[model samples]
Target: MNRIINPVIPGMAPDPSIIRVDEMYYIATSTFHWNPGIQLFQSRDLANWEQIGSALNKGEINLRGTNTPAGIWAPHLSYDAASQKYWLTFSHMVNMAGREFNADSYIMWAEDIRGPWSEPVYLTSIGFDPALYHDDDGKHYVAILEWETRTGYQAPGHIVIAELDMDTGKIIGAWHRVTKGFTTRGCAEAPQLYKRNGYYYLLLAAGGTGYAHGVEIGRSKHVFGPYEPHPSGEPIITSSPQHLFSLGDPDAGHFEMYNPNSIMQKAGHGSLVETHTGEWYIAHLMSRPLGDKLLNPLGRETSIQKMQWTEDGWLQMKDGSNVAKMETEGMAGLLGAGSVSHDVFDDFDQQKPRLHFMTPYREQQEEWVNTTERPGYLRIHGQNSLFSQVNPSIMATRATSFKYELKTHVQFHADHYSETAGMGLYYDSNNWLYVHLTYSERAERMILTVLQAKLGERMEYVHHQVPVPEQQADLKLVYNEGFADISYRFEEQMEWQVLLKAIDVSYLSDEGVNGEPGEIGGFTGLFNFIGSVDAHQHDSFADFKYYCVKNE
Candidate 1:
């Protein structure tokens, strides 16, 4: 039998909420600052997963001008057996300035997973990470983290629960404040309710979202009451099992808690499910930092660990340890991982683009990107500059591997220097490294140039430029351990020549951006994209023949 690998879903897919309906498993994760709000994935064998669709595919909410890591937060996916419907609840965090996390939560339902979802019903703006639970007694409840803004209080406030009227999206009674947390690892959030063996269990993510992150558990006889901590008085699962000096520090990159013995870090924010065979497992968020450094370019990913219920009626890791592993036992009789591949080679021949493609800030305008107009090619009509939060003609996918190569062939005639089209690595509009084809008055032809934005500072490195005789060129970027090599070739038959080699891109991680030490940096990972820019006029377009990505 084959073994199961960690990170069932990789690259910026965080705060996973999972559910099992019969033999099939479905998960929903947060997609911050991306157009299609919540990412939904499906799997059968627990080892292989594929993206089916997004929950918020339509234009219900506007994400224009949304800041880094502050759009759609944690999304909870639950199924009601009686009603035969699937429910999804999530928070749209608008702002996080001055630690004032103002957000509005909403709920929606559908009959099928790939669904015509119901319109979003407003919940509240009290906090983030809202979840809906349907009890056997036909009652519904909502759990959230009531954010505390006043001084002299526990930093992130409490985990509260209340009866919810599903029809009206309103709370029926006063909010009942549960325990601040079961232990000293504060910043308790992402509350999930589970029932097993006559007890209502509350699972939370605590110790912030840095190196000290973990998942803790508590139980109570009643749905909303005084919950009791686990017997261990510590996190039930974590990447770092040992205690750290920075317990209450809100900093993101808590280097003190880095577990040198483990490959996974920041394991927390989990959602649990039980298989048809009565086996237990938890899908949680984990990160793999650059070798020995605090930098994480791939962002938080989704990982799974086998779980078991102890004799004392508490859930714990199957190994009786908190450290997350790279490989684990597979489901019984599951022979092979499925053939759903993450790598892409789109030749612009399909009627609809691949499911993994996503745009920034707003939804993709069909007029700007079209494949029907030009057969066998994707034409991107340039709009605003990449720095603008409004309309940037960019199509991207997650950067899934640390050692990978991305290549795209494009044809564009640049009348002025303002028009450019090519491929690059993008974190956001404000932070990216682009190698594009643009008009160069000095060279009097189409030339390749590099543009970089590091923490809001934009600069054009002129030395990494080469003149091309033809209007069509191939752009390639290779990334390895926080360093990127940019190269280009003029023709399909020509050999690739290096333009920039071993450029330090460690600053593209969450710790490198300029922001508040603890609360400010970007949480989204890197992306590989093909885009265009028309500063002079929005008429110039680029025709892309193909886009391919492969792990090196």
Candidate 2:
């Protein structure tokens, strides 16, 4: 049997909610502040995955000026077999200041997954990570994290359930407070309902969103009554299986729970699916850091673990270990569909942008970004600066690997000092590294310069003037681990020369550029993009011949 790699869908795909429609498996993750909301992926054998399309593509919601880590939360995807429709439930987290945690949840449905998805119907403002469960008797239920605002309650609160009307989006009854959590790992959320052998199982993510993160489960005979924890009272799955004394601590980045022996960390928030062959597997959110560091540049990614039920009916890893693995055994006799292909090369010859391409906060403006104006080149008209959440003319793809080379060829004419176009690593509007071509007032010609943002502070450090007779330049960013080498050349015939070498960009990780003390940092990982800025005027645009990402 072939082994499946962990992080089946890599790079910022977190809070995964999965469902199997026939032989095909689909996973939808939180997009946070990024536009074209929920990043979605599809797979056949639960191993090789492909990013197919986004669910919130048509401005169904407004994310303008949304803060990092505070827009779209966990997206729950499910199919109602009776209605023959697909249902998606999500939360729009609008505020976290003072930990008020004000958020509104909504639900949408469609007959097909490649959706003409219905407009979002309001669910409730009770909490975040709302999910829908379609029961056997045709009753629909909603489960969510009930935010605890009172002083004496558990910091993040309990998992609550209530009956819901699928058509009208109305809660039929008052919220029933279920278990605070299955274990002592206090910060519980992401509750999903499932049934097996006359027992109703509630799977949840516990221990917060840091080192102690884990997947725990409970079961009950009744749908909304006293649920009992698994006999062990320990998590069914976790990256750090070792006992941690800080189980009830609400603080995140419980660095104390960091398992030195494990390669994967922060493994939790999982969704389970059963295969056609009767095998059980879970697609969960997991993270990998740079080395011994807790900083995750790729953010929380999706990983799979094969599991089996015990004679007692409780779920356990197939190998009988709670620890997460980097590789797991594939289903027996199941040769998966052909490996999903990633479009790493874009020659600007296609009529539409690739599915992998994404923009920050707002939808990509077709008026500013187009390939039709210049047949062989992608024309990106300059917009707001890269730091703006408004209209930044940046098109990007997730940095899937730590060691990779991103190259792009651009022809830019900057008449003023504020106009620039180039390629570099981006995390969000407030955090990024850009090596752009701009008119250097001192050099009297187009010059290459490096701009860096550390915790929202922007700084310009190194500069080099391009040699004369050079209009179009080939730019490359070589990232090996946490160190980045940014280089450029005037002509393709010329060798790549380093403009900035061995720059320690480890600060670009999730921990480095986080929000004010209590708020979570950017959960979305690093991206490589080619964009332009027009602080002087919107008349300037850069034409790119091609963009390529090669994993080293």
Candidate 3:
């Protein structure tokens, strides 16, 4: 039997919500602070997946000035068979200061998966990670974590369930306080409800979203009742199978809980789906650190595990092991299926940016980024600097692999020092490595140099500056295992000259950046971006002939 690789949908696709409708399967993941929020993917064979489109591409939400891990959180996707519509429920985390975790949840429906969705219906401000369950008797219920603020209460709060009026988007009844968490490991969030064989199952993401993360389960015969925990009293799925009982710990890092033997870390936050072949699988979020340094540069990724229900009516991994695996048994008939190609080569011939391209903290409006401005080229009018949280003119894509090559040809003319255009790697507003073309007043010429930001401190590599004879240049970045090499050439036929080699960029990872007091780091992954900055006049723009990313 063929094996399905871990991370079926890789690279920054976290908090997976999987479902099956007839033959096709769909998965939706979180896209915090990245515009066009709620990344959605479709799969045919479960082993292979493709990004179809995003749900919030039409300026339905504004994320300007959003913090690192604070925009759109765990998006729940469901299909209402009776209504013949696709529904999405998500949280807009506005504040994390003082651990208040202020968030507003909303629900929206679409006639088609990729379509004009209806206006958002305000749900509640109780907590984050809200999900909707459509019952058999035509009743709709919403399950969420009622965030706790009391000094001594169980931190991160209780998983509550209540009847929801879909038409008015209001809770018709009082909230039923469910279990804080099924397992000893606390920091539970992301409650997903399911019904199987007359039992309502409450699946939760426990042990925070870190090394000790896991998927815990509970069940009840009635929708609102005293639920019973799994018999094992432990998580059914986790990266680290070691016994860890941190009942009230609200910290999400759990760095000391990192499992040394497991290749996949932070394996939790699972969503279940049953295939057309009657097989069961769980799609969860996992991460891979950089060479045991415990720094996750790619952030949390989506992985699949084959699941089996035991004789006692409990869910577990197929092999009766709680440890998540990197490769698992695939479906018998759909073993060797074709997957979507990840290599991107965009020439900007179309009217809009490609579906995969996303901007930071703002929508990709045509006024700043457009293809019609120059035929066969993408014109990006300069706006704010990369450090600005609002209105930064950067078009980026997820860095799907540790070993990949990003290349682009740019035509930019900068007369002022603050005007620059280039391509490089980015994590957030505070961390990045940029190789840009800017004018040097001292040298009286256009030059290329390297700039880096680590924990919000700026550093410039002025020694590596190379004079560009023309206004356009070919740039390339080769990344391999936490290091990057920057190279450029003036013409297409010339050999690429190295500007910098073996730059240690491991600090760009999740655990490497500095964040809030109790948080681990930023919850976002790295992105390859081509952007322009004009702090001087905001009149300069960059024309890119092509953008390509190829993984080795």
Candidate 4:
């Protein structure tokens, strides 16, 4: 039997919501503050997946000033057979201060997956990770986490369910409080309801989103009831199954729960799907940290597990192990067709950037970024500095592998100190490592240098500045095991000169930043970005001939 490697859809694909629409399988994952939000992928075999398109590309919502891990979360995708449409429900997290976690849920539909979706209809402000379940009777129900704010109550809140009017986007009845979590591990969220064999199964993500994360389950005869937990009294799937009882713990970074022996950690937040052949499988979020540091620069990724339903109707991993595996049994004859290439080389000859490229905190607009402005080159007008949470003119793609080479050729001229353009690695508004080109008044020429931000503190590598002779240059970054080696060369020079070598950028990982004290600093993974900053006049722009990424 062919083996399917874990992380079928890799890099920053957290909170996976998987569904099968006939023969094709689709998965939608949380995008957080990245605009063109709600990354969607389609897979034929569970082993390989391809990004088809995004759901929120039409500016349905504004994410300006959105904090890290606080924009679009937990996008649930479902197909309505009665309406013959695809339904998407997700939460827009607006605030995380004081642990209020203020969020508003919305629902939308589309006749086609890659589509002009219907305008977002307001759903509720109950909590995050809202999912829409369509029952066989044509009735619709919405299940979400009812955020608890009481001083002593269950920290992250309860999983609640209610009838919903699909046409008006209104809750038809009172919200019924179900279970806080199915197991002793707390921080339950991402509730997705499914019916199997006359049983309503409620799947939830427990033990926060860190090392202890896992998938827990409960079932009931009715849509809402006192659901019975799995008979094992534990998570059906997890990376670390050493029995953790972290009830009432709201912290998302459970670093203490890291399993040293497991190659895949933080494996949970699963979405279930049954294949056309009736084979059961689950698409879940997992992370591969760098070495033993437990620093996940790629953030949470999507993995698949072959599942087996016991005669008693309980779900379990096929091997009867709660521990997530790095490799599992793959569907026969489907492996070869599912393979996809990760290499990308965009010459900007087209009208728009590739669908895989995403911007932060703002929608992609032609006014700030366009290819027509300069034929054969993508022009991006500088807006705000990378430190700003508002608008940053950056075209970025997820860092899909630990070892990769990112290459780009850009032409930019900066007159002021605040004007700079180049490419580097980004985590959020507060953390990044940029190797940019800027004009040095003292040298009366363009200079290249490295700037880094860690925990919101800025550090400049002024010693590594290299004077450029022309307005354009070729830049490259070689990343291997959390370290970056930056190189640059002029068009005339065939050899690439190393400007910065072995720069330990491991701080760009999720565990390196500081968030709301106890919670995880960030959930989105590191991104390889080509951006420009014009804090001086917002008029400077960078024209790039091509952008390329080759994964090793």
Q: Give per-model TM-scores.
A: 0.97, 0.97, 0.98, 0.98
**Candidate 4 or 1, higher TM-score:** 4
How well does candidate 1 match the true structure in TM-score terms? 0.97
Candidate 4 residues lying further than 4 Å off, grouped into runs, are 332-339, 516-518
Tens digits of per-residue lDDT, candidate 2, 178-255, equal: 888888877888899998999989999988788788999999998886899988887888998876544445547766
| lDDT of candidate 1 over 1-552, digit per residue (tens) | 667788888788999999999999999999988878899999887888889999998987788888887899999999989889999999999998888999999999999999989989999999999998999999999999998888777768889999999878889989999978776778789999999988999999988888888999999999997899998888998888886543344335566788988889999999999987788999999988899888888888999998999998999988888787887767776787643456878999986677888889978767888788788998999878788788888899998888999999999999899999998888887888888999998888899899998888888989878887889898899989899999888877889999999988877776666557654277778888999999987779999999999875
Question: Who is ahead in lDDT, 2 or 3?
Answer: 3
Q: Rank the candidates by TM-score, best first.
A: 3, 4, 1, 2
lDDT of 1: 0.87
What is the C-alpha local distance difference test score of each model? 0.87, 0.86, 0.91, 0.91
Cα lDDT for residue 522, candidate 2: 63
Give the C-alpha miss distance for residue 334 in model 4, angstroms: 3.1
User: Which residue pairs clash in candidate 1?
Assistant: none
Of the candidates numbered 2 and 3, which has the greater TM-score value?
A: 3
The collision pairs in model 4 are: none
Cα RMSD (Å) per model?
1.5, 1.7, 1.1, 1.2
Q: Worst ten-residue run, lDDT, model 1?
A: 244-253
Error of 4 at 424 (Å): 0.2
**Residue 201 shift from truth in candidate 1, angstroms:** 0.2
